[model samples]
Every structure is written in structure tokens, then in C-alpha cells.
Target: MNLGPLEIGLIILAVLLLFGYKKLPDASRSLGRSMRIFKGEMKGMKDDDVRGKEEATTVRGQLAPPAAASPTAGAPDYEAEALAAEARAAEARAAEARARADAARSGVTPADGTR
Candidate 1:
């Protein structure tokens, strides 16, 4: 399995004949450009992956430690907090409605309650 220099030359000649010298230059230029773009894209993807991992690590580090804020016997219930928020929102709406009705009865024109 030894291909001598002459055989290699013949192979090159055959390839040159199959694709003319003019076309070969254009093809080689396009191939080089394609390879360059592929290499650049791969580098960009690797950099993005590294950046993403670093960002994840930074976010993880920024978090409060588990021991610092563990649930205790006196912790407030989330459900109760949510219900309280809802109640406050309802009260605000009711207050607004009452104020609008009072303004309408008094025939007072506020900035936004013309309707």
C-alpha cells in the first residue's frame, strides 16, 4: 500500500482535469470562507455556553444560604398572606367605587371621574 510521488502527481492531475484551475480557485475560496465561518460560529457557541454557566454559578452564589432562612415554627403561612393581599385589593376597589359614587351624588367633577 505505497502510493509513490508519481502516483500522487497523477491523482492531482486527474482532479485538476475534473475541475478546471479557474473553478478550483473559486471553490477553494468558498470552502475556506465556509470553514472560517464554521470555526467562528463554533467559538461563539462555546463562549455562550461558558458565559451561561458562569452566570448560573453567579446567580447560585447570590442566593441566600439554606441555613439562613430555613422554615421555623413561627413562619407565616403563604396562603394567609395571599388571602390578606386579596382582601386589601378588594378593599381598595370598594373604596374607589364609594368615592366615585360620592362624587357623582355631590355633582363634583374630579379629574378622571367625568363618566
Candidate 2:
């Protein structure tokens, strides 16, 4: 199904009627920008896929190397990491609470509700 000149004209007319001439330039500019961004993202995805394929081929003969191989990597000690992260988060929450309390006592609103 080919859109001849008449079909194209009708579509253009419909668009003009839907969005007046005054708004056409802004709409067209936005459309063009969106298309360019979409094209760039698609190109990036294609490049990533190609690189992944190349890497897979290169590693086909040998075992893939470990992502991290520190002395502590032997044992999967995720529990320690989780605990450390939790402790940090708890400290942050405590500090925020203290800031809010101080702000309330001083009769001033905290900068971000937690200062």
C-alpha cells in the first residue's frame, strides 16, 4: 500500500487540523528529536550485541574468568556484605531522625525533612 501525493496531502491536512499551523514547528521538532534518540539507542543496542557475540566467541575455548577473585572471593560471604550495608543504612536513618528532631526543637523545617 503506497501513499501517493493525494494520500500524503490528506494526512498532512488531518495533522494540520488536529494541531494548528502555529504548533506544527514545535511538534515536528520534538518528533525529529525523538526519532534521533531512538535511532541512537537502537545503534547502541546493536553494538552491544555485536560486542557480546565477539566476547562469547573469544571465550568459547576456555572457562570464563571469575568476575572478582579476591582472597575472600572463595567463600561466597554475602551475609557479611549484607550486614555491613544494613548497618550503614541504619546509621543513615538514625542520623536523619536526629536531624529531624533537632529541626523540630529549633522551630525550623528541615531542608529535606531530614536536613
Candidate 3:
């Protein structure tokens, strides 16, 4: 249903009469305050989630063993190289999982391997 200016004015008049002019300002102010508080809380939660993800990413980066962390001075360290590759694959899987989780949180259904 669409309301023109006349209908809107009538609704406003009814609300003013029901709520009283003096109480309306206080009610509106409280509503604005509540909205601001809600927005602040949502922002804090988003920031915290982002910060947690950053920390997790750092931890994932650090998961490589000491040997796998860098090139060795001795003959080719095959084992360490393998570990490094495994760690990288694991991190990639984790990143995909994180992406899926983020999509889920945002109410977007993640697409499977199929079209």
C-alpha cells in the first residue's frame, strides 16, 4: 500500500495525538541512542572477527617447522621441503574453508565443486 502526503500527515497526526508532543522527542532520542549503540556493537564484533582472522593467518604462516621455515645449508633437505609443501597445501585448504565460512556468515550459500 502506498501512502501519499495526506495519508502520511494523518498517520503522523494520529501518532502525535497518541504519544503526545512532549514524549515524542524523548522517545525518538532514546530510539536514536539505541540505534547508535547497536551500530557500535556490530562494528566492534566485525572488527574483532577480522582481528581474529588476521591472528589465525599469522599462526598458519608460522606453522611451518623450523627446518621448513628456510633453506638449509646442507645437501637438499627433501624432508623439510615436503613438509613446507604440505603446510602450504594445508594453509590453502584452511583459507578456502575460511572463505566458505565467511560466505555462510553473510547469508550467501557457497557453491560446491559443481556448476
**lDDT (tens digit, per residue) of candidate 3 on 1-115:** 9999999999999999999999998788657655654565567558656755554444436543344377657755555555575566557656765665476446565577310
User: Over the full model, what C-alpha lDDT does candidate 2 score relative to the true structure?
Assistant: 0.62
- Index of the highest-TM-score prediction: 3
Error of 1 at 14 (Å): 1.7
Q: For residue 47, what is the lDDT in candidate 3?
A: 67
Lowest lDDT sum, 10 consecutive residues, model 3, at 59-68
Candidate 1, residues 1-115: lDDT per residue as tens digits?
A: 9999999999999989999887997777557655654565567558656755554334435632244456668864444544565566557656755665576456575567333
**Segments in model 1 whose C-alpha atoms lie over 4 Å from true places:** 1-3, 60-115
Model 3, position 21: C-alpha lDDT score: 96
Error of 1 at 45 (Å): 1.5
Candidate 3: lDDT over CA atoms?
0.62
Q: Comparing candidate 1 with candidate 2, which one achieves the higher TM-score? A: 1
Which pairs, if any, clash in model 3? Answer: none
Give the whole-model CA lDDT for all candidates, comma-separated.
0.61, 0.62, 0.62
The TM-score that candidate 1 achieves is 0.48
Quote each prediction's TM-score: 0.48, 0.46, 0.50
